[model samples]
Target: MERNLELTIRMDNDHVEIDVYEPESGECSQIDAPLSFDEHPEFDAAVGNEIYSWLSLWADELAGQN
Candidate 1:
């Protein structure tokens, strides 16, 4: 079986929100926090790494179930 995963990122002046959706199972996960862009130049890369880690862990758990 194949699993479908979707990721969405939304940012505003005060914070950044990251949402993960598994459409096949209607499971959703999110990560959000206050961000100061001027203070942290590595914000984008850091957040990207976090999301990738979440996806990898989710995938591994799903694979183990099968």
Candidate 2:
């Protein structure tokens, strides 16, 4: 089944966090080394490249909001 993903991002001056959740199925992928989003390859590529990609992507988004 194709479900819309929900991302919860929390960050501060010293830390960055990205979390993925498929609410319908309750599958969650949190901020951890080698973050896994196998069930959802879309995000697997978005934030899969270590913490670099994860923070980079969201950092861009957050910056744009300002």
Candidate 3:
């Protein structure tokens, strides 16, 4: 089956944020927002195995840190 997901990554001066959205059910929740690559390498490893792995593919573009 094919599915669509809305993933958001936000960063403030001192905060890093990540939100996951499920359009089918209109449900949303906070996952994890690792501030820097060095801050949360674990989040990176965990997300790599997820369906939203594509989110990481665009991390540079979205995070504006690359």
Query: Which candidate has the top score in TM-score?
Result: 3
Candidate 2 lDDT, 1-66, residue by residue in tens? 123568888766544477877666586777633334345464455565544644565577678989
- lDDT score, candidate 2, position 33: 31
Candidate 1 per-residue lDDT, tens place, 1-66, comes to 445668898999888887878786687777676777567656666668766876787789888999
State the TM-score for model 2: 0.44
Give candidate 1 regions above 4 Å deviation: 36-66
Deviation in angstroms for 47 in model 3? 2.9
Q: Which stretches of candidate 2 lie above 4 Å from their native place?
A: 32-46, 49-66
Itemize residue pairs with steric clashes in candidate 1: none
Worst 10 residues of 3 by lDDT: 51-60
CA shift of 28, model 3, Å: 1.0
Best prediction by lDDT? 1
Instruction: Give candidate 2's whole-model lDDT.
Output: 0.59
Clashes of each: 0, 0, 0
What CA RMSD would you report for each candidate? 4.3, 13.9, 11.2
Span of ten consecutive residues with least summed lDDT in model 1: 37-46
